[model samples]
Target: MIGDLLLAWISEAGNGTIADFRARAAWLARTENLDLHESATGRWLRDASALGHCEVDWKHGKWSVAPPVITRLPLADGLAVLVGARRQRLLRAIDEEGVYAEQARRLGSSRDIPPPCTILMPYERTRDLEEYAAALGAVYSGCAAAAIAALLGTTAPAKPTAPPAYDSPFEHLSSFSPQTWAPTLPSRPNPSEGLHREQVNGRWQHLLRREGGWYATDLSRGVFAELARRGETVIRWRPDGDHRTRTGTVIVDWGASLPPLQARALVLCSGFVPRFGSAAETSLYDNVPREIAARVASSLGQTLQTSS
Candidate 1:
């Protein structure tokens, strides 16, 4: 169940423990289609701990879930599965019906389809953290909520003719405007550096050696842009081969989406900067659908770069 995944993640976190995991918990709740406020995260964690799923030690500021040595315990019904199923059925029907209808009309259906470009949420005043967080989670929330709302069709948040800009969600995020929005190439590193792997988005991505000589990711431009925006200078990410990457000296946690780029960029709650760069010009992960791009960037620790 979704809740199980959330708990499992926390349990599998560094040292199999989570210290001060509020923001990430909030974001996870949204993705699971739970209308949970940030404050609710603690209650949820406590409830899970009480249920014998995890151990909560507030004094030490940690939540720990010790996996069963031999057996997996079943969890209760997590959320509204009926709603999720219905949405999936609807999407399938839409595609099937559209294809049949098009074929009847003697039109061809392309196997490769660019999803309908509809704004799920447009520019709106930051009324509250929930709304802002929801916007960031429009895609992440899946069919349980955000995607469901988008499928039902909603009005754009801003005027159709003019797109909108957004405030960076983090107070520490960079606020300076660039003389030129274009990315400055990442600084060079010593010749010893090379491509390495790092744990990101629940998986691993390569930290590549850039032309500038520094070991960074393929999407370094966007990552750097997000860091500068947040006024951050260093990325404390885990690389497969680097001892520093494994050390707790620096830790990264994915936060809310990059408001300016939405899912195109996402911040790490711990660092208050982007976890990966999102490519802008190409349709790829550097060139792919927004959803796929986000996943690829997550696995690889990068997203496409775009300007505000």
Candidate 2:
């Protein structure tokens, strides 16, 4: 089932990095209120590649659907792979008695069943086969309706919709503040001045607007100092662990707001903030606010001069 979803997304997206796939998967989870785990997307991508349904470019770190001729897998081989993957999960679940107990109850077996660990005791792997089969059948039926919808094209890629117009850019920022990180303004005569001092005293920051909202990261913290300095509501995101070196590469949940025009500008001018140890920064999208765009261009020019 996951394999089918992966193929369909890859086909529609043409080609993308694992990060791109994960981003889209995150969006789907938010919009559809489904339990589409990001880790599962990466796992299924590898599975698809292994099954010859997709091709991976190791050097470029991109994936695309394989040629039709090489995409077919023998039914028995495919089933073997599915069973092997699922069996591992079942083995892990055997250690959690609550899982089997829930399944047993769902399968209409109210009588006290053997503990999950005991169900697969040494040399008795098939002792509870009937109970396991019933549990699996129940799960299958629960997802059958959604699976049919997915197969029938109801789960197509979302179309980019127009963002609503705002009287001021600040209003636009506020509209997405709930999903993205917005700075808490100080109660001062000139909040911008106070915010500027705070940001400059901190480490450099990076920002990117993708899908529909902004994602910001700072070397020392996950704040959008520059945007905050401008009284702009910038969303904040922190990496899972010590991932400061690859801050720009992290994927985050930015909600279901699809402000395409602003998102496109951010994508086109993604280099506005230089990466660590790199002297690259520029604004390529002209539609961005003039003052911010000018500063980005000026910063890039200064960097070029210093490097020269």
lDDT of 2 by residue, 55-149 (tens): 56533558776432101011111110111122333435544533242121011012211111101111122324334434332121111111222
Instruction: Return the TM-score for each candidate structure.
Output: 0.22, 0.23
Q: Pick the candidate with the highest TM-score.
A: 2
Task: Show pairs that collide, candidate 2.
Answer: 180-235, 181-234, 181-235, 181-236
Q: Which stretches of candidate 2 lie over 4 Å from their true place?
A: 1-3, 36-38, 70-308
For residue 172, what is the lDDT in candidate 2? 17
The local lDDT score (0 to 100) that residue 291 gets in candidate 2 is 27
Report, for every candidate in turn, its global Cα lDDT versus the true structure: 0.30, 0.30
